[model samples]
Target: MDVSIILILLLAGTLVTLFSGKAAGKVALAFGLLALGASVALLTKFNAHQNIGCLGVWMENPQIYFALNGDGLSLAMVLLTTSLLPIIMYSTFGSEVKNPSSFYALILFMGFAMVGTFLAADGFLYYIFWELALIPIYFIALNWGNGDAKERQKAVVKFFIYTFAGSLFMLASFAYLYTKAGNFLIGNLSALSLSADEQFWIFLGFFAAYAIKIPLIPFHTWQAAVYQKAPTAGTMLLSGIMLKMGLYSVLRWQLPIAPYAAKTFMTIFIVFGIAGTIYGSIVALRQKDLKKLLAYSSLAHVGLIAAGAYTLTVDGLRGAVLQMISHGFVIVGLFFAAEVIFRRYQTREISEMGGIRVQAPKFTSMFMILVLASVALPSTFNFVGEFTVLYGLSSINIWFPILGGLTIILGAYYMLKMFQNVMLGEANPKPFADITFQEGLTMGVIIAVLFFFGLYPKPIVDMITPSIEQILSYTHKL
Candidate 1:
């Protein structure tokens, strides 16, 4: 009931906002706040030791349960999703984005799908919500995206087809599991006994979807163009939260169901993830477009996160979740900064930008802080997560940490280079305005979280540690 309330509020907000016409953005913000309130209520109940909520037999012949269970992991993700919605909505205030009603409505719907994905306990229900998320984002990108029509169309289509095709493999795996377990419940699927061969195929099936979504190395070709073409809001949804869905699925679905296969192929997955870390960093260093640069930066960060999870160590899983949350906040802030830049300077090319600090010191300062965080500065939230991940990788092999840690140097190099080129040069003749009050609030909230967690990460680490232990226990038994 508590979790469902969040979804109901969002879906209801979607309808209300659609009907709100010109006032849709305001309505959307209001609903986002309400949903955030519900999220708070859920957390409160969780703290007070109350049942969060669960409703089963809610869907099809195969059957899917609608659950709002607030385990540590789910609660953390719920909080991330709800909190980001209002901030994301607020970032759009006073802007003219064609049909404001539809745009805001899609944002709410996208939140609904993500929350559902986080809370779902039934495999079929999880799959449904997972695919449901793609719909809103697809339309969001297809309609609101900025670029040449042909380019936008190509990017959106490729993104859509790539993700959808990957999902079919997951669906097939779920069907096979249903046959083996006689139900679609996650518990049953995780507990079902299977041979090494069976586990290998199942793991591969899940990996297909996850790899495409995470877009690890060879699978990531579609991401840069799609991110560059999409509007800033759409880019945030994709980079900030949507991509995490893939990484989260690896923890929630892949490892548990196919522990043997996961163990068997652990090195393969880790190598790919580390390869992506190095590969994405190299690509990012060369990007002319700021959005594309950040997109590749995101890829590199998530690569390390993925590598952490594949380690199957408690520290690795813990680090992965922490990084997911931290990355979500940081990436959104960075993308918003990019949007703010685009709004002011009318270009995303790093070559065309310079002396922003002279013109807009406030913007430069905030952007610099975010960049520092992304580079895992010692006092930032990312530092804790990145350090933990490197530590986790080290357990597998000292070399693993050594290789994966390249991201830190590469990240700082590209990030500082971009910042120097864009924010620290001679002032452009045209007046470049500093961040407005709204932009400041958005970036400020994110920075505050990063700082707070960076200094004192024990609360989140404590909350998620037991859950990480539970997951690691499953892997150990296998």
Candidate 2:
């Protein structure tokens, strides 16, 4: 598994997809299939004990390396990104975009940036990819987004400034760490010693970046608007894969680099996360616009994932990783469902939709499965992750789990309400079409993966546990 191939293929996909003109979606899907093949090869070749690389010595004086590697943690994320790319492209096959070429090109480029972020083993390389990931999405939203021109501009610009500013803080912190350690390798940074106060400051700097990316609580003002305005593909990128970058950063960078600070402020971070969970759920309950509702729902779920990370226990960390994957699949499916409804009715308001189930039972059934998964029903993938996270929270303190558990009740209430408004009740008088074959393929694939993992999660649990344990050991040693 030459890690470089994944990046090259994605970049090539971007160019080929762009040049393919009106068939850009098909071109992108072809490239995505190729990339998935490469990722599968990488997964088979990956050895958790050794850092695999096709290139090295990217810089001299700074001693940076182009050494792309895949531990279990990174490979899982890379697989997720590659797996979703084709589905996302396939979902767009029937649409007439303003510029199909550029639209699909940006999506492919976004995939490259995200894969780079996951596989990057050097600190500076990680930052480069982190900032690079933001660029494509910004353009996607700014150029192709829905709603008023001025409003979309404001939302995209605000998202840009917010994430870019946060990245600067992260860069500053990394620079300080570089000066102290004289290198930018992740291993070196993790091994460096810092005083409690220094660790606290570094932690704060990283927190600003991750929090904004995760968009926890007060820092989340940019998310709902940006998510609502971005074109569905762009929004899928943001919610499905992008948010996990922040949560993944916590496990990969923040906790290990600033162990004392992580330990010292664990309670505060958990409390803030719980607050975001409650706040997001409550706000979602009132949202009339379906996109905004899912956006807020994402906020709530991610908050719980972040809180689980702060728990610093095996169950918590594993649950966070598992839930990240679950949320990625389920949320993408849900948003795609939203787009399906919008395509038929040309409206995103819940009040405007009714009795879709009567007209499109296949679509309705799939949507119901995803909705139930989101609400964490038993025998579904989300249930396993949520249960583990709750168990982790309970291990820390009973009240923490108790408070976070409100998500179960709130999740069911809001999700069921949204489903009832959009899919049930008296049938709409307007003619409605059943799910198209392409749409069914997309939804069917996602639903199948969700069900498979729900019943047998041991494979993923086995792959990620060692990396999570390694992270825990490093934090504990400090």
Pick the lDDT winner. Answer: 2
lDDT of 2 by residue, 380-470 (tens): 8899999999999998899999999998899999999999999998889976799999999999999998999999999788888888988
The local distance difference test score of each candidate is 0.89, 0.91
- Any idea how many clashes model 1 has? 0
Writing each residue's lDDT as its tens digit, candidate 1 over 308-361 gives 999999888899999999999999999999989889888998889898899898
Question: Which regions in candidate 1 have their CA more than 4 angstroms from the true location?
Answer: 47-51
> Which runs of model 2 end up more than 4 angstroms from their true locations?
none
Clashing pairs in 2: none
What RMSD value applies to candidate 1?
A: 1.4
Give residue 453's lDDT in candidate 2 (0 to 100): 93
